[model samples]
Target: MADPQDRRPAGAAEVLERLGRLSLRELSMESLLQTVADLATTVLPGDLEASVSLLVRGSPTTVASTGQLAVDLDERQYERGHGPCLHAARTGELTMIADARTDDRWPDYTPRAAERGALSSLSVPLDIDVDEQVSGALNIYA
Candidate 1:
């Protein structure tokens, strides 16, 4: 299988061209999310599902989501107060959920995420607050 980040659709070239030309700081919050959605659509293989979240006060909130399933899964993680994403965001560790159904770590969240078709996920911590611990999370859901 191709690397998920290398996947692209018919119009992906154009979208990537635009994405490459813009900086995140130059875009509005809404535009930033749209750009992320566009990138997720074009850069991910197969179904190309994705969601991005920001951590505030140790809680994760969806900043952008390409589909409902992704949003639901993120919310599930937030609701449970524990999940790979949350842990990764707080501790600045890479969290990988290869298969939510079989992952025993998130007992409360795994089943719900699996029900929403999120088989795997990756959480990358972002240093939103330069003066504090990681203030946000950037999650990639698959």
Candidate 2:
């Protein structure tokens, strides 16, 4: 019989198991988020990079990132005030750009991100709130 773990997606089990072992009480929010960003890149099939974008008091900030590309792309979004990551954080909706070069949803963002070598992107909203004023999203790029 095949092990159930084999049926699961790549890195899913590892990420979940690692997360389960975390001492949430001991880690700061920034540390926890950084771990999540790092874990995200491991699950995807390509050479991916990730970042954690937090929206606080209507401003967006990159709190943690796995690489410089992730941070640069995230900042591009923040500069425009609307991009996959920011949209996901603000709306709690998942945003995906299969190909940044052709994605026109964010005319101001996609082109620049593509120029910077981020050909694809995925932003998953995080249901995290801090003092009723914070929202977040996990952003992945490749």
Candidate 3:
């Protein structure tokens, strides 16, 4: 049986169109994050799940997630205090784990991620002004 979330990869044009609509919506930060997560799962290839992790008052919080899997994965990293998403949020750098099972950097996280059926992950830091203390990471799991 096929996963219901599986679908054909979206074209660049379609992705752009969906993003453009985001600008027109009167969405709050939470709403915007949800929209972004939904769009990511739809536009990206592979059996992907998406989530947004935000650092508020120096604590990691999952502001939005496409599904429970995303929330669970984020919690795994938060509990261990290390993972691709946490690294990206702190350093403002893109962190890609091509194969979670083989990734030696986050020994504790890799195994848990693998158990969740996440073979790979990509975490991108959301750009924020230097004056703003807020930090965020956009996490994709496959």
Clashes of 2: 0
| lDDT (Cα, tens digit) per residue for candidate 1, span 88-126 | 767778888888889999798888777777788887666
RMSD of 2: 5.9
- Which candidate, 2 or 3, has the higher lDDT? 2
Cα-based lDDT at residue 1, candidate 1:
22
Ranking by lDDT: 2, 3, 1
The alpha-carbon deviation from the true structure for residue 63 of candidate 2, after best TM-score superposition, in angstroms, is 0.4
Query: Model 2 clash pairs?
Result: none
Q: Where does model 3 exceed 4 Å of error? A: 1-7
**Better-scoring candidate (TM-score), 1 or 3:** 3
lDDT of 3: 0.84
- TM-scores for all candidates: the values are 0.76, 0.89, 0.90
Question: How much is 64 displaced in model 3, in angstroms?
Answer: 1.0
